[model samples]
Target chain A: MIGIKELRAGDSLPEVRLNPVTRLDLIKYAGASGDFNPIHTIDAEAEQAGLPGIIAHGMWTMGNLAKLFTPYLEQGFIREYAIRFRGMVFLGDVVTLKAVLKDLQDQELTFEVAAVNHDGQDVLKGSVVFSAELPDL
Target chain B: MLKDSIGKRSEKVRNTIERGAVRKFAEAIGDPAPIFIDEAAGAESVYKRNIAPPTFPVTFDAGVIPELDLPSKGLIHGEQIYTYVRPLLVGETVYCWMEVKDYYERSGKMGRMGFLVMTKYGENANGELLFTEERIVIISEAVRKGMGA
Candidate 1:
């Protein structure tokens, strides 16, 4: 996935979508991550806390977004990855991650990454700076 | 208030990035990539062993600021950023700690809100930085109303 091919700014990187989030997914994330926040696990607790339902952890969504670039990660190091939580993601929503090449210089490439929920509403928005270009391989 | 927590840092916590946690995290995220769970596949890769996910450092948080008293229930995660020197390799012991970087207030529809920024960093045993995670937690109007002091 290293930038073996010639790439230019403005080209959209491949878009990838993860499996629909499930109650068990959140539960597993909670266990693995030690973030037992009830708002992500217990549905009743979430509603009581004024949420539509159990929402996935923002880190969970950000991690899923990172998955989209896994193929290219080995090519270089992640210099920076940032995301703003823009919308709430409920269980059963499939997250689609899209990234576009924003710039390339000095062996570094900047990309704009976005994650959209099932309804096409943007759930997360951010940018990533990687040490190399994955030549679209 | 959150402002009082400024400049506070967590205790130096050390933990090993184990394979079991990596497997669970990969499975939980529905990532079927073999390198995440298969040692054979990992051995064949550049790292020569399983590597944790990019955001895996979040799990290694030392703890929240002790004095940063904000409403416990109505706090929302605002923005987050993770910058890595490299993907954390499994089986490496990392020293982790965090500190309150910034705290400020702003007006929103709900009313005045407080945003607290904390930066967490993980470094290998040799004292080389592995990754840095910056988190922003916001206390909403509902939080203040709930406190009602």
Candidate 2:
């Protein structure tokens, strides 16, 4: 488990690997999140939307990132985190998530985080801020 | 009759926020960077890995469906903030619990005033708490000529 004290500005978080994008993953996400946007499941819909191919849901990737810190951030230490959409993830694309500690305090922590795809492109860009003394997981 | 309409208009949906889907969203927004498509693209960056686009979770990670009975001119997305432990990647699955966190009704000079806050919680596949997002939207009655349509 990673503790906040172990991180520092310009410090990168551990790397996380993901499984291949599968139809089941998308279907399960649709059912679980209540977002029935056809573009997620149907290739025709995505093509109609002028996309290159079917894509995964944005939140799913974000969830994967959360899973990385599952052991550390079980409590209320994280205060605020937000990201801006910049790129896309094609089906079967293996994505990775990395974060650098931007700031730290006894009560709060901040980091500039990024998500990148296989070809050296940025899929998501944003900053996250969390409380330092958070609840235990 | 109204109850049924309400039920039909407002319904809870299960959503999964994944990485590949975030890439498509980037395409929709006119961004086709490989970082969103291929994992190796992230190798050079300090992050040392591929990551999903921020706010990509808004697509499937579940949120409360609002019932708009009033004839509003336009629904405008004002602002949004997401808090999370780490950045997201392509194949991760997360469950969404969405709801109307708050609402404000006010009377303006021209017509009625209203604002809505939609909140959603994204949980990992293991049912662990991931993060929360608050979406703010504004609604107002449209000004029409003669009798309002």
Candidate 3:
């Protein structure tokens, strides 16, 4: 139902607010991602690794963004999405997800996406590219 | 710290980013896209070859820099952005280096502290610049309540 033309530069997606990271979330993410770095779910282990405490997987945060774009790119519009880990996120931190249209081509659609924490820090900075043509159902 | 006699940047550490590692990443997230799995399907996509998910590049030999690490109760998932020079193939053996591109601090409700973390990556198997991914992250108390703390 969503079309690329509907999204334009400065258009904003519905705001996504997620629950704070809990030990359970980390455990679930570890089980799902199989990252089991120990630093993410184990408090002492994280400290030993020179980290403040248990942190969340970078992908988990990116997943929320993927979820946000799913409705628009549902059929096959999204070509790619990605991000690099800059800061470590620990249990209990709140992250805000947002996006803005950057450019659109008859061949592809693109936007700039970012995740900001409670402190107004841009936690994740990346782009999402989508196919301009709609897929046939 | 003493300067090296050769004056060359010491090989601090080499993070071997591999498919198996990325496979873990894809598995950790439960992404079953054919391109991420079936090599043939990826090759056929507009990207012209079997490619990992967009995030795949991050796991390919990512080198983390210090100071980007913030002291906190835990690391939080913040913002993520990716641009493509071309889609990555499943077994292309891509290599990358990560650096702390930027960092800053500010005052806020949690008592005057804010930070931004950024990293850039250069990719290749034969030393070619494929694409660059600059990731930015922020840390603050405002995140606590906003995330339902």
Best by lDDT: 1
Best by TM-score: 1
Ordered by DockQ, highest first, the candidates read 1, 3, 2
Model 3, span B103-129: residue lDDT tens: 455676656344444445555656665
- How would you encode candidate 2's per-residue C-alpha lDDT over B25-91 as one tens digit per residue? 6544334456555567656533454455555566663633554343332443444577766555466
Candidate 3 chain A lDDT trough over 10 residues, lowest sum: A70-79
Model 1: CA > 4 A from native: A1-5, A133-137, B145-149
Residue B146 in model 2: shift from native, Å?
22
lDDT of 1 by residue, A17-77 (tens): 7877888888888998888889999978999998989999988888888876677655665
- TM-score of each prediction: 0.91, 0.53, 0.55
Note the DockQ of each predicted structure. 0.54, 0.12, 0.21
Off by over 4 Å in 2: A74-76, A135-137, B1-80, B83-132, B136-149
Task: Give each model's whole-structure lDDT.
Answer: 0.81, 0.60, 0.59
lDDT winner, 1 or 3? 1
Candidate 3 root-mean-square deviation in Å: 8.7
Could you give candidate 2's per-residue lDDT for residues A1-137 as a string of tens digits? Answer: 56667776777778766666776677776765456677778898889767888777666565555434433433333456665546767788878787788888776767777678888777766667766554332
